[model samples]
Target: MTMATVRRISECFVKPLHDLSQEAKQPIYFSPFELLFLNANYSQKGLLFAKPTPTENQDFSISTFLDDLRGSLSATLDHFYPLAARLATRKQENPPSYVVYIDPENCQGVKFVHATVDATVEDIIASKDVHILVHSFFDLNNAINHDGHTLPLLSIQVTELTDGIFIGGSVNHLLADGTSFWHFMATWSEIFRSNERDGYSISRPPIFKKWVLEGSDPIINLPYTHEEQFIERFESPKVRERFFHFSSASVAKLKARANAECNTNKISSLQAVSAFIWKCVTRVRRQPNKSETICRLVVSNRSRVNPPMTENYFGNPIQSVSATTTVEELMVHGLGWAALKLHEAIKSHDDTAVKKLVESWLRNPIVYKLSGLFHPNLVHFGSSPRFDMYGCEFGLGKALAARSGFVNKADGKMTMYPGREGGGSMDVEVCLLPVYMMELERDEEFICALESN
Candidate 1:
């Protein structure tokens, strides 16, 4: 397949239609969870294929469609004002700190770009080099979270395809996680759809108030002298990413097998699937020098906290916990044993554990960087299958497929999304060294597990 050329047609900043100056504006400090993601950005793209409407004979005007999207996005920004706000630094304090606040007087709106791709949606999606082609659909591909001080906290790119459209979004990880990101996207679509019909009302309005951990200072300081020091950028080695689909029946079979082997029903489908991937990758990458392997699971603390945060809370509240084992033990013990290890690791990270992590980070601020987080023997699982990704629908209809940007692309990085078919199905997007990926694709045991019973 040939490379898809994305030509920029226009670009502008989209601000809220309503005046934010009428309301109180205060700087919202970052929670410990938010602080950890100061070096990363979450970028994703959703493809929407055109569907025939009742008036199929009428010509579809791209200009009209762009106008509706811009108008709805502007109105949606009224509720999610933080996305339009810029990250500010407190230099006068004893130790300089970072805060995200909406400057009503000088609001820097979110960046919006209009572009056209030379390829069709089907061609791009079906291409074997899709991992490289999808990067053009997003903005801020090189900008990290700290760049938000000067750059827009959120950037969106709408690319027109030959047969459909691609809506891509890139938000600072410090501002929101996958849950909050999709929440904003769904709301934007809701408002857009409402414009076509009747009344405009969002089901869930975002709560911008920061969540403070117990016994922790609301204002957290960073050790860096300048904001530039916070930026840690590195080009990752060439890696291939492939999507592996696990049907509901296959997942059920794996879950049952794990439970039967462990003599306990506590093993979850996620754990079982995670164990399967970990084993496959470990077997392929196992070296005599490296005997240990670790699987880091990204856990959400929204419902795990003491009083539990609402689903509408708009910020990052996630933590990563690891399940470690020697290669010998992992390989000899089999999938059930590996899954139980993951289950125990996840179970142990309760409310108390969450608090402890926050306190530890407070004492010693450690920003998560790609270099420090990844290793040859590590499998970093990010994102959740529970997020309502396919539910994001504008007037165009539900998304045909979901793709991510250049951020967080590293060997051993695995992102999970709900399969397009839903019903307990999962799509695991795996990134690995080309050699390991090739070996994984050829692994009969791993491939066999994906088949529905």
Candidate 2:
């Protein structure tokens, strides 16, 4: 009936009910890929919604729901024990370096926050502004942080509304990749749904073995920063984040058109959409003809690994592939031309190639200079079509909507997820400077390709 209001109630650290004894604990060595996240500046946040019970008497209460969730999370942690551990540095060497492991004393547990909002789940879902929704549902800054040797790798915020509840999980990028992170969330929901305390089981038990991928030598320590200053500058009120939905039919048409333009290759929906958006963004910027621009696509190697890491392998298993083209080439090229180049980059990194990439990084370990915030011309893709966003049903129900509370704040960032409405559709979340967004929203080509609903 009126504007919604949200307020925090309480917060506490949630630890596992059972302790991981020192003798039983093990340290999983960080592969060069996993170590990259140790100083990565971003965390992921996901919200799952629950509708009110369908009874005349409102028997359910927030306290009871939270208690159940907390217990279930603890149980899930026992299986995902590393999540509760800290990222401690090994200082005995010449320079300090990080080691990934879980020991009894180093585990600080995950932070759990309780909050309430004077809004209905439907209202929050209907709101168009992602920033408002994220701030209303989460305290983004405090969700994940690295302090000294102890890194609180994960934190969760649960918000209760008049008609429903929203669960937010924020995980450090270094601890797990998007696939592994969602796997943990799904397992937590399963444990709660089955109400299985004893003999609890998971479909895919996460493989914690890291030595196989860990190279022979560790490199010198390099200072890493999330570039907080760079992030703060663009996080001004002038920046805006907007959601652009691409219906299944719309994506099909784009793919068909792209394929038709290039007789030699057929493009994927992702490449088509990416090329389409990239052109629009570059057009909006209207950079000089002499300038060089690049598009970064994060490719996951879970399937491409030597033996193929389990779908549930728990660590960073992704690499960034970049394609650079001069402004003249990018602007003059047809969508198919751009799409073809993007497709080639994605295809080039097969399993053996990915293995070499990891080995190369191990040999000369260095922090990447580019990030989601470090450059304006660069665009980084987030999440994949297989994240199973819609199927992420907790005991309450399937989520009405789900989005990244963090990625939306950065400049030159784009995230793709499976549409909540199903039918193999996809949703794209784009963040850009206000001036560029103004141009993009007015571009007929971009506007015509997108379906608002």
Which ten contiguous residues of candidate 2 have the minimum total lDDT?
A: 227-236
TM per prediction: 0.94, 0.88
CA deviation > 4 Å runs, candidate 1: 21-24, 51-59, 93-105, 129-131, 196-199
| Per-candidate RMSD, Å | 2.2, 3.6
Tens digit of lDDT per residue, candidate 2, span 313-384?
787777888777987898888989989989998888887788787677666666543333355576667787
Give the Cα error of residue 225 in candidate 2, in Å.
15
Query: Candidate 2 regions off by >4 Å?
Result: 1-5, 21-24, 48-50, 53-58, 93-105, 139-145, 211-238, 369-373, 407-409
| Candidate 2 global CA lDDT score | 0.71
Instruction: Write down the TM-score for model 1.
Output: 0.94
lDDT for position 58 in model 2: 79
Candidate 1 positional error at 302, Å? 0.5
